[model samples]
Target: MADLTDRGTEVGPGEFAPWPLLTMHLGGHPLDQAQLQQLLAWELANPERAAAWGITPANGPGQLQERLDWLQALAPRHGDLPLPPAPLEQCLPLYWQLWLPLALTLKQARDELNRPLIQGVLGVQGTGKTTLTLILQHLLEGMGYRAVGLSIDDLYKTYRDRQQLVQADPRLRWRGPPGTHDIDLGLTTLAHIRTAAAGEAVALPRFDKSLHGGQGDRSDPEWVRDVDILLFEGWFLGARPIDPSGFDRAPAPILTEADRQFARDMNAQLATYLPLWDCLDRLMVLCPADYRLSKQWRKAAEHQMKALGKDGMSDAIIDEFVDYFWRALHPELFIDSLKRDGEHVDLVVEIDRDRIPRAIYSPALAMI
Candidate 1:
């Protein structure tokens, strides 16, 4: 597979080198630098900014600095994090500006709920859900919480099951979409974690995308114990179904009559995932500056894979792959709908073309 964290090159206005903020050879401030100073100034300039983001409410003066200091002390251990070649220094600005705040917010949510908090993160291709969960787990661990990351992919139907599914509906040529997951399995695992006692074993389902000729299948369940927080993320995580009629005049990709039917069926399938979404204590979206960028991001990922001398889909294949998902659940309709429904969504982090967060605000607050 390509570098999971690779957001590829430019997608919107302004050019960006592939992951400009990531570096393996780390040398720079871990914290308390220009980025930190700028963030502090931004927060100070407008106290309401924190409230709008739905993070832990800022307390008296210097509380934010105290939080930063606490996070800074834990930053060094992350300096050489090898996943996708990101360094602590290079990621410091994002940490101080976006991620650390999210960690703090998760901690606050955990404190409110006696049971384990299941936080759902929804992001499209290259929005950094994988990296975000890993970093958030680290920061939450620093804050004295046992946080674990789980992907919706893990809940996929066994290969044999999916084979049967494809036979029924040829439209599902791939694993992702709403109907492919074992919703019951997800509900069971979450329920087990929510009520698991200290030191009690909780097994999370794992899926291997490389298995069965890339058809993907369930592997052994990973045993973890006493998880205080679960960061559940996926491409369409937490997406809710829309009215079937919405597909009548659907956008570009859903142009054909067959395409509209597939979309409508997917909208119905989304209803099955609601019980799983109900399992979440909080939901946040890592939205793109433009949903269309996902196509470009997928192509970048494929290009990176080929550069590594690994087999990858051609640009034409990549287009078909991404467009299929968009047809199933277009960001314009489903994800944007989530952004509008503040009652369910807790936070929205708008990521720019460079995979940098440009805005972080609550949906209700954004309306204001």
Candidate 2:
């Protein structure tokens, strides 16, 4: 075993201790004591590195070590405590790449999503909605706010129940749309979180997408969280009614004229949930540049599923499946409603057809 103390020397004034530098890089691995020492040593030798990270040298080695200890303690609780592959110096640029702009936007929108308010984020499939929810939870927690994420998908009806419905209708291929979920159960959970006694534990529903439905395992550890900020995100979260004429401009061709009529019919059916939007304190829309980009993201997600040793649909099949929903939902419903009712739609982050985010919407100037 390598002695961590022998690998690195401390530098900087006694008040600000330099972080260590490591020779052996652990890519995608958790930081061990040896690696941690090396990083400390590198920081000591290059004090300017600390400045770049916004880390002040005012805290001596002991304080720096204490910070590391705190992070280590937080790791297991968060699960899979993996460190960034790049060196601290190299990682700084990546942080600024996304975090800087998002930080500025977040600062402007922070009050809307943080503290005593319920934030609802809505987006179509493959919009990175879940990932953004997790990121928001992490960021909010870091800022000393207690935040939790709950999805409507979790409250899905049981597998057998949903299977029967799908088998009966055939049109209900996916159990993700509004009627497939248990709205009453979801509303109850949210009510509990909002009005329940402090420290109360409530059962939360869990969705098992691999099984195409949910399991009755109510004992999952995520249930009954005591949180200050609750973020509810899902597909069709803020979906509303739209005029039938909006479908005239859709680019994707249907099988026949009747198929086009069916698409318009489905949009009209979702009108029942328009009232749900009033429950949200704020709404943010993650608009991808185009359907093609959304399809690419779906492919990437399928690939990730395969990498995780899970069974997944092929790219072509996934694209076809997503297209069916987009053709029915996007042009006739979501896009038209957002464009028409600008007040309720707080922000629309423009994503290209390739699924790359180009710019964000500014309601003040009405530009992306």
lDDT of each: 0.78, 0.56
Q: Model 1 clash pairs?
A: none
Off by over 4 Å in 2: 1-115, 212-221, 253-255, 304-310, 331-333, 352-357, 364-368
Query: Taking the tens digit of each residue's C-alpha lDDT, what string does model 1 give over 287-366?
Result: 88899888888788778889999998998988888889989998889988998888888888887777776677788776
Which RMSD values do the candidates have, in order? 5.3, 10.9
User: Which candidate tops lDDT?
Assistant: 1
Question: 23-132, model 2: which lDDT tens digit per residue?
Answer: 11212344566555545555545443343233344543443454444333333333321222333333222122222333333433546554345667777777767766
User: On a 0 to 1 TM-score scale, where does candidate 2 land against the true structure?
Assistant: 0.65
